[model samples]
Target chain A: MSEVREPQSDERLQMPSDPYSVPLDKIDVAQPHLFANGDHWKYFERLRSEAPVHYCEDGFEGPYWSVTKYDDICHVDSSHNLFSSEPAIVLADPEEDFELEMFIAMDQPKHDVQRKTASPVVAPQNLKVLESTIRERVCTILDSLPVGESFNWVDRVSIELTTQMLATLFDFPFEDRRKLTRWSDVATTDPEQDQSIVASEEERRAELIECLEYFGKLWHERAGNGGGSDLISMLANGESTKDMVNKPLEYLGNLVLLIVGGNDTTRNSITGGVLALNQNPAEYDKLRANPALIPNMVSEIIRWQTPLAYMRRTANEDTIVGGQTIKAGDKVAMWYISGNRDEDVIERANEFLIDRPKARQHLSFGFGIHRCMGNRLAEMQLRILWEEIVNRFDFVEVVNEPTRIFSSFVHGYAEMQVVLHPKKA
Target chain B: MAKITFIEHNGTKHEVDVDNGTSVMNAAIDNLVPGIDADCGGQCSCATCHVYIDSDWVAKAGSPDDQEESMLDLNPERQPNSRLSCQIPVTDELDGLVVTLPEFQF
Candidate 1:
């Protein structure tokens, strides 16, 4: 079996000839082109209705089950005992030579312990302390925007702000903060497809190893000092994680987890919020009328964005979900993006309404024990940014459609050109 | 301001003065109370901030609404006086209020 299935050429990937007439087996949702070309929602909509628990005989990694319905996704996410997260949590299995074993991919006692070690960083007390710093950063970014001049919002705003926050969380060197963004992009981006992100697997590993080496120095310093509260210091000194340094790979795994955890979700959501607001001008007008809606609007943006589309789980035992029997060792991807758009669970699911009731009830942050720990932090970042945006900017006009990321897992934008208009003082 | 006491399952107590409109979950979060995870940040979505209202304060904290009731139903340790702390808004009437945290909150 092939390890990495290179995507077919674009000519073969045009809109399916009778999307309705296409046989169920011919429908492979793992096609990266569908995501890159921004045509995945229609495919997922068909799948959710036609085959909620459909099994794709040939996925990018291998054959797997696609749990598309909201309830079924919840069933899969909650039944962690039956569907283990170990080995890897994405569609592609970790490379045999350079495996990553983050705690999110672990089960039971280990997952709980390691999660507790990092949870304090996102705890509300800490978030409250970080809020002012976040606002200051947001102000600086907003103020520095090239007024009336078009620029790539993804790099100028999303990546910069998220990278700065990530650096603050790790207490990494401020000048080297962009390295955190690079490592985060490297951790998730497919080196083969996204050459701009990373050219090759060897280069990716070398860059990641560089990340490990840089953090290793901080580990020694933090391990020796009286232990600060940053994530690195916490991991270096926590009762459960203190000895992780001895296991270099595991330590690297956690670093990748924290960096990516702090990076993509917020970054894309920030960019996504701007795009959503631009796409739905009435919602933007409503937001402009009443900034109190920012909190709820932030939740809606996250729901609409649904960054990190699907998380994969390996079946530990044969289980039947929605009349489909997933055999042992089969990978099952809970299509959270589909579930977030499922009309059955969410009222008016496809519409982007800022005032939607139960706005926070989406699968974007995931569910169960493995729910995104940085969820509050992500929401806060969006909430604060919007608050700042409404206070200062008259509008952020989208120049054109965004260049979408070419990955099924990371449902996000690669770049978005925008022109900013500021409110006159 | 209202004074509320959060009691950990292990018998540790933390007292904080909270503004009237603030949530019990926010008060606990503000004071860094150990067990109130509040993972959803007072959205009433996650039940990580589950707390059992002390009998004396149950009348003031009132019952959780339907949305909170459904969320609390997911918690295995939920009790009759149980409320998702994020759903309970602090007020002058709730002064001297006490809520006992479930050990599972951590």
Candidate 2:
């Protein structure tokens, strides 16, 4: 695994921060610092106007194409046959020794089958069953927050609510719920990009192994228990996945997928909504005036945050997207973050509008088969949180600038200080 | 013009006059019909526009193509007559076309 790790190039380290100052060919949006500093928007804007289907030959994660336009992203994402999601979905190749098999990074028959087996847990029908439980949890978390003092909303509200929801989904032990949050952070955290979560790749691997062993015990207890609706039981009993327990790595891989899928994405969005509303007070006022806009505001927040920045797909055959000829075996990134802000598709795309029409029609949840399975679940959680919030607090005020996450993959905040103002009776 | 009828999951009916080339999904969305989301617009990518073709109109509305099938197959709530409304183009073959929208888009 150490031998497979590529050393960072000095040129990449010294690359200019300004998008316009650098040559068109020198633009590499994959750099983690750009996103960390909130400087990615200008870079993507330049690429969208000058070179929508831009390519970087010498990136830290090797060469990859950036699909920046909204329609072009749809084309790449929908054409599953032309571009395959194999090996991994991030720009960096998976460690050869620790390669894990998960459905989102797979194509065709296998992807469809495994996804079908696990998706029922978060399906709309099941979400209806989970709604009341989620509201109850949301209320408790909100009620516990200190109203007068400023606190890190990311840790207190965002992380706590999402972590609790994930525990309920897996029917996991309520006491060890924060373990889910740690594993989720470790799963997506690249030590090269951010060492705050884990000191090194070896540490990341060790923590994930610990997570596998923990869930393995649960799998054993539930494998033959006649199939409960919880995710672990479904995977343990489903026809295609029942044998997954025998394959430790495969079992671990699916566990990480479900964990991170349910965790980091929603956690960041929850935090992002508070920050967005604070930044645009008029929109916040709109939300306050009519709490009915909560559902629509949820969609707008997801689009604005775009929790997971982009998904990487390797081209199976030669393809043409946005007038550029992408060769076979090229890495293509469908930049959902950029696409969600595209002016051509989304009118007045830059501004944050809670009442935006056709709010659900955004690329935040990528289109095609690999589209987010937990989208409805995420929306429900946000909807319920905001609904309860409006019923209680006058405002969830962002007291200071947020410290953003240091990864391009997880587009979110690390910490945000916010003070809750109670509604005047 | 083709007259299309969309039935909600609760049995409410909506009838609209659609242009010859417009899709059933667009017709529903254009007329402010409650059920259809059409998240991917007219593209057959997302299965949000899923609808059940009436038994009488099944033959004329036609079966899903390969792309549509790939999307629809992922849906757990899909029924025998399930078709993505985005894939069905409105025409004058039979004016009184009716399709039922699923309770949830999934």
Candidate 3:
């Protein structure tokens, strides 16, 4: 097996200004800087048009085929049998010594068993119970934001709201709610690419172990309590996951999954929606005119953001995708970000239309058994956030270009300065 | 065209005339039915189009195929009569088909 190589951030800076200038075979969209610079779209645009199933042998994370077209991504994602999500779902392999075994990366029977146990917490029925709490939190967060002055929207609103939501889901100590945000960032942060959260792999693992130890205490406390609605309680009381306490790594893996799953994705979408709407003021006008479009706009925002860029799946057997042969054991990346913008699949794919018809038909939540479990929850948060924003603010003006995350896997904003213009009475 | 009756979780019924060969999921979507999301657009990929075939129409609706079964099995609320509406095609064999939308589409 070829070892994954980390492309230095500076190497990506040397990429040509024009994506087409790079030879077809040399185009590697997985470079984290491409995402950080927000220059990945043209590269994916070329791939979707020229080589939809193009392979990058010297990619930062070893060799992987990029599935960029809409239908092709759907085919690869839905065919879980042929394209397994085992070992790891990111382009790079998990460290052998400390592999976190989350259900999202597991195959069949085991995946189904573990996923069912935790899914109920975010299921629509439970979401109804959570709706009011979420709205109350949203209102509080929005109310606290500084008005008419530039502030980091990502920090004040996006991260704060999502962290509070995750804390409520876990019933974690309210005072330490920000710890969920830190752990979520630690879990997904690539030490090689960015050391903002942790200086090295060891530091990352150490922080996650702290996370494990903390959740372990919660698990023990709740395991014998019989029944409760929070995620920790659900896992503790769940038949399949009850014994997870014994498997420390597995227990931590799931906690990381739920945390990162609930946190970063929604956090980015909340920030992204504001940036998107500001970029397209007409859509903001449309939104102000009709707040009824909040639900549909949420889906459109998810599609436009494509928060998580791609999900890696290892081919279980030799299979053909987009007329190209993928050998068994080869890595394949279903670039949801690219597929969401494939013009053939999404009409005016490049444009950010607030009320696009069939807006929910995007690949952001993925497909098949491994599809996003927290999708409805993410949508609900965005919907409620927008509803409250429109009611209170006439405009959430983006004051500057947003600082994007420096990872291809997590396509999101790191910081976006915005000023809230209060709605006129 | 076949007549399809979609009953929401709250017991609201929407009767629509869906053309033959249109999926039950599409019929609900086309008619703007509230409960069925059909997120994957009738691919049987996402189970968002999940519905319960009214007890009377259970046998006629038939058992879900292997792919549909795999998707349906993921739903915690899966019942014996549960089926992904995307997998069910509207046909003349059953004109007055009634399906109840689940409280949530997970």
Q: Write the per-residue lDDT of candidate 3 for residues A373-416, one digit (tens) a residue.
A: 99999999999999999999999999898998988888898899
> CA lDDT, every prediction?
0.84, 0.90, 0.89
- In candidate 1, what are the lDDT values of residues A199-266, reduced to their tens digit? 77887889899999999999999995777979999999999899998888899999998888889888
Q: Candidate 2 — which residues are off by over 4 angstroms?
A: A1-3
How many residue pairs clash in model 1?
0
Cand. 2 Cα-lDDT: 0.90
10 residues in a row with least lDDT, candidate 2 chain A: A1-10
Of the pair 2 and 3, which is ahead by lDDT?
2
Top-lDDT structure, candidate number: 2
What TM-score would each prediction reach against the true structure?
0.83, 0.98, 0.97
* Candidate 2 C-alpha RMSD relative to the actual structure: 1.3
Best by TM-score: 2
**lDDT, candidate 2, at B98:** 89
Give candidate 1's error at residue A295 in angstroms: 0.3
Cα shift from native, residue B7, model 2 (Å): 0.9
Clashing pairs in 2: none
Interface RMSD of each: 7.8, 0.6, 0.8
| lDDT, model 3, position A380 | 95
